[model samples]
Target chain A: MIAPFKTSYLQDMALTKTPLAKASYAGLLIALAAIPLVTGEFYVGELGGLFIFAIAGVGLMLLTGYTGLVSLGHAAFLGIGAYAHAIMLAQGVPFLVSLPLAGLITAAFGIAIGVPTLRMSGLYLAISTLAFGSIIGTVLQKWDKLTGGFDGFPVRPPTILGMKVQGAIGTYYTSLIVLVLVIWVALNILRAPLGRAMVAIRDSEISAQSMGINLAVTKSIAFGISAGITGLAGGLYAHYVRHLAPDSFDILLSIQLVTIVFIGGLGSMHGAIFGAVFMRLLPQAIAMVRDDLPFGLGRTPGLEPSLFGLILVLVIMFEPGGINGRWVKLKHWCKAFPLHRRAASRRQKSYAKSERLR
Target chain B: MESLVGLLQLVINGAATGCIYGLIALGFVLIYKATEMVNFAQGEIMMLGGFAAYTFVGKFGMNYWVGSGLAILATAAFGYLLDAVVLRRVIGQPQFAVVMLTLGLAFIFRAGAGIAWGYDSVAFVTPFTNSIVKFGSGVVLGADNLSIIFGTLVLCGVLYLFFSRTRLGIAMQASSQNQLAAYYMGIPVRRVFSLIWAISAGVAAVAAILLVPVQMVDVNSGIVGFKAFAAAVLGGFGSIPGALVGGVVVGVVEQLAGFYLPTGFQEVTSNIVLLAVLILRPQGLFGQVIRKRV
Candidate 1:
């Protein structure tokens, strides 16, 4: 049954999805493991923040991109996660134990609040989440006893294994490890029955339900998983910044996360990476421009949002599939241009023959 | 009873706030109803209108009456231009694209205003600054609040009349109800849409004019878009009366929540109200419960 193109599993020699793929993936992992060893503290610190944001973005990609749930309020979960961690650290709880607990708590909280998501879709869901986010932000400011109000609460760095882990390198490695684990979990989820169920749910809730997929459970689990991931990111953010403020979890950050998921490409892991890196780097890039540009452009902070908004709009209008999608399409077209043209002509000929038969 | 007077005041305040919400929601509904696009820019438009009016009188040395009129017209024109230049091009895109585009527009408008004007909040002086009317008991209505209530009433009344009585408004309404059917009936659907866009913009300007008196004029004033959006949802997205009721409910709830709730609970309360409404009655108070068929 093997055709010329189908030479067993050996012929399926893609860079991913095989034993060879695992080896290459492991090799890539080793290289990444060595990145902090050679990189400067400033670069590692920035990358650390980017990694944290990417983890949050991955959660969003699962929820919004894959499950088709629109949340303009994931930042609130991040805030919740951060506060959980901050509160824990303030009480002298070790960071290692607190982080996972924060994530679990966030997941539970997400499911509790996401109850409305079972019935609502689109704008209703968006508004519902947006409202929740705004409320969290306000409470973070107003709940002085717990959140420490707008000025924010201080967090001490966690000591681990009798070693004082202070500095950007430790933070970067911590963030990097978390990001790798998140990526691994996300990849596994994408491949699992639950992941396919999410995609099916996204594509058609009615069809999935008719196929005996429990809508409520699936949706709630997706929300929970997404929130847990975001919470992990949040805990990291709190520890990294060493401060937790209400303003840190405003609606704008939610929008920023949404923008990253969209611009990175919906439903693609690579897109999440692309989006996180670009979004993090873009501001710094703009800041670089500000530093280097002539006097007129100097010392301006408002330009960043405007430019960001402009890019977001442009991307939505011109590139609905995002950077990853565009890149994939480009590569595909480049690799098969000639064969695609010949096949198109052949298909047209067959179509004409079929039309005559009809 | 004095309680009756307080209830009346709450009702008055709610309705007045509802008027502003309705007007702003009218911006969302106008665009959504006609083109199936939710204009996140509506809130920013309100901010711009408020800021424009503030500047005209405060900075440009224009009279209050002139500034108010000019601000409305200018913002209406800006709305029309946005429709023509940007929104129209994005027709037939995914609803998400349209939504995010407007969201981006909101950021641009708010931040742009911030850049143009400093981040500091400024007071907007309405023409009826110091006027007050004493109710029979101790309840006194500030002239500013009274003007807002009366002005919104007049605007809404006129809008209702325009939609029902005027031919152009009727055409716009028909278009919003069903574009294909209206077009088949030989209505200039696109023109009516443009007109609605203009009218909605004008309505937002009216809301800005009314609201600026009470709230500080700043980039944050645009955040009222969500409050107004909540009002729209509470009332019913497409229903005029629903928009009014929704806005008032949101405003009064906000006020009451502010007054009675814990120090920082007002913000959370509004969202809780919205979530409750959605879970309990997603169709909203006055909205038609649409059932889709496969």
Candidate 2:
């Protein structure tokens, strides 16, 4: 009876309002697909760069946003995946087999770390992950034969489906396809019982345990799943960049991933995509301005990180929920129109309280 | 006989290095006690402290003692300003917010230092008497090592006295233990926090000064701060003596592991040791083990 009743027109525009909203999602997908056609090699490569980070950001959202595990060593899993892919390639394994194997290996490593560290909470867990990243990078640098040491190893592009997969377009297509598939899997996982358990733990681990969730098993599995996704991204990144170095997978990269996920708004898949694009493109956009602007200071090489830090500080201080959150407010305003002003006034107090808690 | 001598030398050197780690970890512990937050910029603060001293002595042609003292003072002031401006607003925020803020601070400080001092590593002259002392079976220790060990010991002794015997230190300790109760008791919680930042910065400067003699100074020197953080966790969070033991354990483990482990594992010895400590006994050697009521 409720499904057959007519809904108010205003309610239809909100996310998850109806099946019609999802049907319109196809339009957005089409627009993304058409981007490569109009964009040149360099620009497509740039978008591909965003996709690489988006893949990892998705998993981090699962861990930090949904699973309540703050990982500061996610780059280690990425490194593992990249190195695993490289090692497999050197052994002449096919790309199809190598990528999945890399994910599996990273998942196992994650489980190994998670099982031992399941008892830790909050800051301890974060630092442990940071340690993992540091150790992994250091080992990669020292293991000369396997990782090619400090000089790093050059990766050959994977050949697939009788086509010699190479260059910007090939890599972009591969990345896009993989990202879409991974996202579908992530959404499915999020809707499952395990996903609800992860969220329950995030909201209140004690409560989750009280309700009969096996805390240790759930935490480890979440970690393993997240690591596996991160590994997939890393494998793609190595192939696309065609180079792997210890410096490429530093603690800073892990920190960056966490920051991007935060800036996009945690626990939202759309937020992950939004965050990935913003982070990857921000520096590039700044560099573009530097090239165009007449200022001498703009030409400096190391300014990117400083600028990134400044932007991050500003975002954290002023807009904790990030761009996606802003979009949500904007959409709400557009739909509410004349009533928006009164609604926003009532929201301010509650919003401030929530922000403080976060 | 030669191997025994080698082991002795390694232990002495490790102890000296551990002293520096302990000093840095002390900075971390102090800040955590005051703010209940990790200062990721602790290492960068140490780097800036070293660079400040370097600039004063090398560029300004000042006496070493005067330059070092001035640099320490400057770093302490900087630390206070950092807390006042950035950390104050996030007082009740989640731990991740503080972590991110410190991470950002670290990048800013590191990049700013890179610009000011240039990226290349530079040599720093220690003010200590640069003499090497030889012991039995060809074992040797440097004067700089002696200074570091002595300096850290003296600092710890002074801190112990200050915390236990002085009004301000005791009040600060009370504030860290429970801010609400401390406030009710008429302790100025905010003032104690600012003082904690100042002291942590001062200690970091001392660590930086001591460390310069052992390794060449650069932007990366701040990484020693991260190692110190690991040392702090290994010893047990909020435990002063534990920080000391943890630092020494990490330093010795690193030195010995580098020597004994296959060459591939040498560079990672510090991190591996930290991960092992975290996985096994995270409460640390001197830390009071805690169990959740739930």
Q: What is the TM-score of each candidate against the true structure?
A: 0.89, 0.91
User: Comparing to the true complex, what docking class would candidate 2 get?
Assistant: acceptable
Please write out the lDDT profile of model 2 over residues B1-294, one tens digit for every residue. Answer: 878888977887888888888888988888886677889889999999999988987778788889989999999999888888888777655677677778888888888898788888875566664778776667778878888888898989999999999999999899877787999999988878988898899889988888777777798788887788778988887788888888888888878887887775656766787788877886666677555443
Q: DockQ numbers for every candidate?
A: 0.33, 0.38
Give a tens-digit lDDT track for model 2, residues A259-304.
Answer: 8787887677878888998898888788778866564557655577
TM-score of model 2 relative to the true fold?
A: 0.91
Q: Which residue pairs collide in model 1, if any?
A: B18-B248, B235-B242
Compose the digit string of candidate 1's lDDT tens values, residues B50-120.
Answer: 88888887788788889989999998888888888787766755456677889988888877888787678
Stretch of 10 with least lDDT, candidate 2 chain A = A349-358
Tens digits of lDDT, candidate 1, A1-358: 1112555654443324557758987897788678888988888889889989999999999988899887888999999999998898789888788989999999988997787655655666677788889887887888789988977899778776667777777778788889989988988887777988999987767788888888888888999999999999999998778777789798889989988898998878889989998899898888777877775555656677777788888887667678986776665567676554433222111110100010
Regions of model 1 farther than 4 Å from truth: A1-27, A90-94, A159-164, A291-295, A333-358, B1-15, B117-125, B136-138
Error of 1 at B113 (Å): 1.9
DockQ, candidate no. 1:
0.33
User: Distance (Å) between predicted and true CA of B263, model 2?
Assistant: 2.9
lDDT of each: 0.80, 0.81
